[model samples]
Target: MVAPDERIGPAQTGALRLRLSLFYAGFFAFLGVQQPFWPVWLASHGLGATEIGVILALSIGIKMFSAPLAAHGADRSGQRRRSILVLVAGSLAAFCLFALTNGFWPILLISVLFYALWPPVMSLTESLTIMAVQRASLDYGRTRLWGSTSFIVVALLSGQVLVWLPPSAILWLSLACVAATAAACLFLPDIRTERSPLHRGLPIVQALRIRALSLSLAACGLIQGSHAVYYAFGTLHWQAKGYSENVIGVLWAEGVLAEIVLFAYGGRVTRHLGSVGLITLAGIAAVVRWLGTGLTDSLAAVVVLQALHAFSFGAAHLGAMACIGETVPASLSATAQSLYSGLVWGAGLGLMLLASGWLYHGLGGSAYLAMAAVALAGTFVALRLSALTPRLPQP
Candidate 1:
């Protein structure tokens, strides 16, 4: 097995793992508040549904191009940590501008700026964490579970907070959390090592030529993008269907709770099922989840379906990370990670969210049927991914 070396003692590795976990936990808790609530806030500020969609889509869309650019700069300079810190500082400024703006154009411009700075953080953090795991030989699952746990906690609590506070409070809370992330970044150890001149630019053509890799990326994108309907309008849909905000919170929390469990046991799971198997299973789960969500209006049914997010999102993501860690060279790790984030989360999700807005407005509850179809396509691609490459021993 091609496993990370365990040369560093457990004591040292354990401490670093704790630090990495804390950083991501705090960071994503901020996102947990933002993603679900930001659009609601925009609507509250008198942006129509179409306008709100445009702003959100624009915010995420720019990441497709910007993330690779950021990764290229980091790789070329061999200053990943410095690059992250600079972007975080830039993100803080963008948020400040957002706070001061009310006009559509200004808000849109700030959103683009904010997202441009935002995309690099996750990719760089993943690169740094993977490097740390390799250096200290720590279990990635154990180290990463804290993030999932934190997200659930913040998401549940923020739901109640929204009931008591104005929607704008979400923005302020997000800013505070980002500030904390910046502080955490200051403490993060600089982990950049030798640079490869050969890995300087985006390997667009080369990566696209890898049939298995390309298929996996495409499948993952579609499967993950299938969440656009739910992510953008799930709460509003439930609200319209007469579910209380608290119940909506519980539904969302259920999904993250499942994700936490998945991350907790991720290492063992990956050890038993290879990355391709995991991703394929996730695609299958997504098909079921989206279909079930579309077919039922029952709160219990929705909650049950949301729990499948463990496989649909958690397992699929772990599988993708494992693939990148195993197949992509260390020098190209940031770029590969960024490509995943940019292509899947940025472009794919952005486009799906836009389509979802139209569908939700036009077809109402049945919009999820489209999401299910998307998941089915992803499932087919995932099955194909298994055949494209030889199975490797699990980590």
Candidate 2:
């Protein structure tokens, strides 16, 4: 396959990067609003901690099936951008139901519907973005950093807005961001890659047979999934400790800012440490981060812990992307990305969210200790993965 630059000039390559940056900005802006405050919106409706946890867990768990199924269809059809447009449009429709529903059951149904079409958007986009990287020589981290930038901006603004507005305002803000993302998706490049003809049988089945890919994904999932408690209850925990929404927002944005810094230099970092090293570093950072988060509520200590987001999230994410780029074939890209999103962030995070509910209910902030344990286990897996796949070659 010839590089896209051979056919398309530098101007078009710049345009491709621009479109991707805008899309990331829009999508993650929505996430910025949703991730930090969605629980607040749930609490406004009189739901208990356990109920909120159940709702969050179920939404993500459904993606274990939904994400892979969506990516499979996209791969088979060779229309990933079209599939993404449809999914985001559907997600907008599903989220609108939140305004009509109030109770747990009604909200749960809508959450499942929304997420089934939502989370896969990221996986599909990653597939497209990576294809762009391979074909056009675009930098993945620089392209993705726009998302982190938008997240930081939106989160900081939302924090200030919440100081004046009620929790209900979160739903409306999130809706607007989702609509923006849908609009942005229309401009995404429909880059396609040639698949390996040797591949046969189910894509997921074929993918799982690769020990390096499977183990690395599993290890990454455990590490990322360890964020379940923080995702679900970090805001609530801080509020209970007497911090204001403004402070909570700053804390959230601070973490992503750290992520932004890492992504900005990701190419250099990835070259130095490689994918295995990145995941190993992420596991180590997770242990320190969650342990510190659990052991103290002091703003000073938490601020320091939040800085580790660079390694815990950004590094692990870069590692996973690099691993997929090296280990998976072009034909199975979407399937592999979807499996990472579905199995790792989906099922792995879902189960952790469930356990987090019980742990937080009984032990409060100390629940982070459980997450630390999970991260430590993931670190061991990463070490084993490194031992097994010393150097995975690109297909």
Pick the lDDT winner: 2
The RMSD (Cα, Å) of candidate 1 is 3.2
Could you tell me which 10 consecutive residues in candidate 2 have the lowest summed lDDT? 1-10
| lDDT (10s digit) by residue, model 1, range 229-311 | 99878988889889987788778778888988898888788878877888888888998998888789788888889999999
- Model 2, residue 221: distance off in Å is 1.2
Q: What is the lDDT of residue 155 in candidate 2?
A: 80
The residue ranges of model 1 lying beyond 4 angstroms of the native Cα positions read 1-8, 40-48, 162-168, 199-210, 239-242, 297-299
Lowest lDDT 10-residue stretch of candidate 1: 1-10
The segments of candidate 2 whose C-alpha lies over 4 angstroms from its true place after superposition are: 1-9, 43-51, 162-168, 195-199, 233-249, 295-299, 392-395
Best model per TM-score: 1
> What is the TM-score of candidate 2?
0.89
